[model samples]
Target: MSDIARELNLNPSEELDLLTKWLGRESTEHVRRIRSVHVANPALGLQLVWERLEESYGSPEVIERALFVRLENFPKFSNKDPQKLRELGDLLTELNSAKSEGYLPGLSYLDTTRGVNPIVEKLPYSLQEKWLAKGSQYKEQHYVSFPPFAYFTDFICGEARRRNDPSFSLTPTPSKTSIQYPKYEQPERAMRNVKRHISTHKTDVDVNRWTSQSDCSSFKPDDIGKQCPIHQKPHPLKKCRGFRSKPLEERKAFLKENGICFKCCSSTTHLAKNCKVALKCSECDSEDHVAALHPGPPPWGTENKNSPSQYGGEGEGPGSAVTSRCTEVCSRGQSFRSCSKICLVKVYPKAHPDRATNVYILLDDQSNRSLARSEFFDLFQIKGSHSPYTLRTCAGVTETSGRRATGFIAESLDGKMNVMLPTLIECNHMPDNRSEIPTPEVAQHHGHLKSIAHMIPCLDPDAQILVLLGRDVLQVHKVREQRNGPHSAPYAQRLDLGWVVVGNVCLGSAHKPTTVATYRTSVLENGRPSLLTPCPNQLQVKERFSSKIQNATSLRSVRHDSSVFDDCNLGNTIFQSTKDDDQISSSTAPKQSGTSTQ
Candidate 1:
């Protein structure tokens, strides 16, 4: 559904002017697309014009009733246009202020009225009126048009009725004599068709392997005599005749029940194969699709739209993803290699991600906590006090541990979670590239986590750190908001550099750079953009030539400024510069007494 434009008291022409300059050419184009009679006729506000466009199909009576509303809401004004006042009086009279035989008092409408159409005899009277209104709209929008009376009659009486009652099909019920043929799929064809289906199912994660064989035992020559982990047979159990002789279903059940490797079915053997046990539906026990992927919502409540649509699964622009809260886009910055360990961030808790951001998060592994400095926690949450419980590391170091590592719970780089503390303790370090804790992964009970056994190992042994996670406080992964970024001009345009302190003018000029590539659709953010000026090619060429001539003459010990262009040939002599504005009018200055410069 389209968003309803907000109500505005301004006139349409005024709105169009402001929006054209403020919103741009693209917005003006969209305004042109608006199909409201008030847009060009009465010249209502854009908001009211859009609202009027949403009016359902109806007869002239609908417009008459709406006119009364517009009249009722009007306040008494001094010296209003006489023409508008007369028109208002005329509208009230046409709406039957005198209460004519066919009209209701105060412009109330009857749902049973059908103005002039009889084809809608079976349709509800309201739908009949709407049908006529749609025909009227089509007539207004097109030069040549025909009334869709028969079409609307069928739509209201047949298609709509069938939709309201699925069993109400217009086709006659088939006789019992009819037979339906069963469709079958060959093994090769079915798998090929599955590949085609897979193309449309977009996903972020790629499957690393199609099958697993974790239960299979080692097949090394030194462990050849080891007992099979599955059937307890010897290692390299490919020679087992009994297991191979079993039926497919029996073998599947045996492998699954015995904890044998389902892919290769080796109790103590090698791996790499497929499982014949097709995935079964939990609801029906049928070998087709899984229960989770089953279509339709649970037969509970219609409000539970968490299930995917019966046809298209998720991954369609998040267009229908439980759209209640804002999920703002946060771009990743590029990795700074080694010169800089800092990753800039500006997060807003109460507003959108694109909203102005003054808060920041910079990476400094040399320090303790991840986001802000140690004093940041005390300044924001605590008044020079630490918590009672001291945090200890895997190596039993509590030197930097504050009893209370105060953290705040808010939407952050990782997700919405508690990352603030009363006091921050120094954490360990890791590589530039690290994995994101699954966003759904919640915080484990901190009471149960006391030592190294409860912590995840850093890939680098020397850089072990206590990485935290939780729903209340999100885990900090390597923020990629700067990934493949900080290099492009447009991407840098998004940043507000109020907090940035650059001593070097090379980093960012003391004066702002001139805007370029501006167009009609450009949005004004910080300031007005000046129209781009073309480079002065003639002036540049003349300056360079004058400099060359002067240098040549100077080398020959000549000291006359006017003689610098004496040796140069020219098609026409360029006019000399003048400081006075009035002297620059009309055309170039008249040729001087003896100037050879061009």
Candidate 2:
């Protein structure tokens, strides 16, 4: 017996379990070997195995073994018999269901059999149509003629619809199957319309004569009997056909009469190409040359009464003449006409003279104040020292004449001179009828603090520090409010002594608080003011300095002339300054009041 039979004990349940486990692990090769050994009597061999299975297990087990044996041998005969192939497919479907349900013995036995063709060829007509249209295997294997396939597909689709839903009915009952011919109304209408238009526009003109194949000259010169198509009358000339070919000479003459060519300036002849008079240039050896072509004057040379030489005059060298000579004036003693009456003289000193005068003192008191406040001059330890800086100022006014008038001035900054003007800041207050105190947040609001922060950069590039000395309108309002309230101190006393820091610079309050410090002063003014007084104590400085303001000012006015003195405010100073020693010196400076002449 087999090892599985030997392992089974006398107990039926244990024996059956052992046999089942042995069968589950059986290899396909062993099954094939058994088949080969009984190849002469395959049916007998299968019955013997079934009988053995029945004795060891039961009828159901015997039936299953028989099925497995038949499946194993089915592949061997499937190519010969379509019925066996179909049977094998049915057996595989059962095996697949059993395997899915965890019946391992059936799975093992079924696995030994190669499956039959899985294609469902014998499906119902409706199913076949659907499978042929949409199934992947059917698509790969099947082909059908257009008419038969389409007709059958439509019929099967109709049947499938009825089967899927009994209530579904064919509209007006399905027609008998037949080939469909498409109606072409659009093409028919287009043809009819084209024919109607052509017929409506038809004329009696002879197309053959209009597009005659005869040479143009072959037509008779005077054929008055021939009628003109345009006039519908006989030709004007005795034998002319009305259509006349223009003579070549006349065409050439017309071109020449209009000055179309340089050579042969005649109205009735061809141009130089056919004239034979125009010659090629001897110098450039080019055929494009026309008669009387003259070389013009050089672009940069001054025009003279005498004609320019054919070889180009001596002044007209190979390159530009203007660039070879000095055409620009120096920075001094050059005068510009401002108007019909007044002229502005440009100051250009002869080269760099010895330090004759201090240019720093020449700037206005406001400029001095700005210079004193600037950290660059302080960092260089050059405060109060005369530094040569460039000062540029631009001024404009809109007069009653409705025109914008402008003026500009540029000067070297020397300490002795001052470009002065009145301070633009003015303090004004209007009375109020009601009183209310503004919270700090409300005071800090951007709109309320307009005057302090709204100052704009001046038009002059040299005016480094643009100062708007306007009264704080917000503070004025607050003061009036305080005065109206009962049991309060004076409006001036009630005013806040706060200053706002915008970016790196601080803007001081303009009014309400009567006492305030200058940007360069550490102590409050205490209602004591001087027009051009130096700060007693150094400024209460901050960590960040406004480099944009400083650099713009430096490039504009300070660095125009190179000098040891000009190095005073040449670099960034805000983040570099450390102590009091790096502050501008305290010295009362003179004041002047006038706009810089620009």
Clashes of each: 29, 37
Q: Per-candidate TM vs. native?
A: 0.16, 0.12
Q: Output the number of the lDDT-best candidate.
A: 1
lDDT of each residue in 201-241, candidate 2, tens digit only: 32342221232222112213122124332122343311111
Give all candidates' CA lDDT scores. 0.33, 0.30
- Model 1 residue 141 CA deviation (Å) reads 73
Question: What local lDDT score does residue 264 receive in model 2, on the 0 to 100 scale?
Answer: 29
CA-only RMSD, every prediction: 29.4, 41.6
